[model samples]
Target: MALRQISDAICDHLAQPEPARPLVLSLHGPPGVGKSMFHLLAAHALYNRQPDRPGLRCPGLDCAGYKVLYGMDYTADERAAQHSALRAALLDHVRHAPESLLVVEEYDKLDCPMRGFFRQLLENGPVANATLNKAIVVLESNLGYTELHDLLLRAGDRSKIAPEEAQRVLKDMVFSRWLAEGCEERSDTMKMVGMVSFFLPFFPLERRHIRQLFEMRLAERGAELQNGQLGALQWDEAVIDFLTEKVDFEGDFPIEGAKEVATLMTRYASRPLRLWAAAQQQQLAAQQQAAKKGGGSDGGSSSGGVAAAGRLRVADGGMELTVEPAKALS
Candidate 1:
């Protein structure tokens, strides 16, 4: 996977000894293409394995250690203070845990000066009292989407595009924007572009990829068929097909990606399970009351009848509920 490759690259970079430049990565892609997920997974790969090791911290998406600076969120008046706070926080985190990962969201929205501050940290080893010499920096943006899409199309196959070629294309596309038109002076953003070690492109997810993601999410949520004390839950192909086809319909839009698909599935799938769970709980309570009133053991086990009476059916181009045995576990 591209994420694993990127994680491995970061790991390899971290293994180096006092490298002159920090390992900087620029993730360019459309929205909902999993840039944030990549950051989380990469952190897990780097520090989660042995978290207690001195100076080894898996900040991941932790609000404390893993710092995310949103460019568009800060107003002009707040920008300076935000930058100061960001710098202080970054230094503090790195001082305590040098392996911290810094993620900058909406990189294109940041003012030139703010971008320059980050550039300084990348170019020079230490900023203020903290050294990011071993830290990993990821800047995520959708700035180069058109160019990147064109590059991949011209290559005929995205996977066929060499890393060096992809890097060169990304650098040209990203830095060109940083350099103001008809201006000889290069901005700090342009300088930061030069410091990037890898330009990881998150390709738009395909329908099949969305299907896989749906299945994975289903497994995570424990939405699977259970039969007579079955140990493992079985997923029905029908439900997977229903959600995948729904997502596939919305995939034509440029911004419609995994996030939208996941949202849709959650909305449609989660409700039925929730309803069934509530019904099952009520039935169980009723059964407990009956047992307390001298009912047989069968009364307690009959609670599953409520859930068994719930069925998931696709109708009118969406999921509709009916009263039947629900083969799936909640």
Candidate 2:
């Protein structure tokens, strides 16, 4: 819901008249909590529509006016070169399309010099050979996550914490942390922080949220049975419960959120399907052999037998896996 709200805000900004200041957004969240995905989704939403139409282009090309940079991938030794390249690329894109969106991921990992460059852009409302006053800039980082978690815990209910309150608390925490890291009071990083138009905090997902994500993934994989046919593979409720329990038992809550649960499910779910498929094959072989030996009267049942034998069912009750004989194709 927070993601959707943030997406809506970006969309609203896109629909507005060109303003003097670029829409600078800062996304703060822990790892694997969908911050990167959010950026990709926002790009797709903004630039992927009717790309070949006039004044629209695909984001993969240099002229598309959408750029994504990863801070961690560039180090201090190459900072100057990377900074020049970044400036050139950004200016080129903005020159082509004044309403461009520049996304910088792992913003906290950027060196002070690069941070200063960004600070200059934000302060001046433009960059080399381009006016970014009508563009949108997104900076994503994991900074202030622990402090945010503490704030949420103190509130006892995330919903009870107003958005303004969360943003204020996070801003103070980020500023304090920057100061503690030997940054000057008027450091570039702090200036950039002060210039952010919006501070979107992505909270750690709960068990229910993780379960919903798993269900969505399953739906995407067509993992559902329909009309007594193998329309899609389905997960048993017991298995889901087992996965949830295992996730709960894992040490820190929301350390990796849905990502960790998805990984666990992927690791554990495949073996059962393999075993089940093997058992089904074995059963079909036995049934065919019995039929050939005149053990059953219906020879035409082999087609139905194939369908029935191909059914693979996996269930885990109380962490105990139960593999039964194949049922109908349903």
What overall lDDT goes with each candidate model?
0.66, 0.66
Give one digit per residue, the lDDT tens place, for model 1 in 1-330: 357568677768877887666778889887788898777666655544544456654454332446666654577788878878877777787898776677888776767666667767777777777888777788888777777667767776667877777778778877777776423356544666678888877766666677788778766555443332112323466777777766534333335667767676667777765565556557657766776566555555543332243455554545552223445435
- List candidate 1 stretches off by more than 4 Å: 49-64, 72-74, 152-157, 181-184, 187-191, 223-238, 248-254, 278-311, 315-323, 326-330
Q: Taking the tens digit of each residue's C-alpha lDDT, what string does model 2 give over 1-330?
A: 356567677777777787767888888877777888776666667765543367544457633667778654576588679888877776677888888778888777766666666777778965667777777888888886787777767877778877888788777776766666664455655776788888888876666777776667555443422333333354566555666666642333556766676676566655665565556566667766877677454635553345233322343344444444344424
**Residue 80 lDDT in model 2?**
76
Tell me the spans in candidate 2 whose CA falls farther than 4 Å from its real position.
49-59, 72-76, 179-191, 219-236, 248-252, 274-330
In TM-score terms, candidate 1 sits at: 0.75
> What residue pairs are clashing in model 1?
none
lDDT of 2 at 75: 62
Give the per-residue Cα lDDT of candidate 2 at 182. Answer: 61
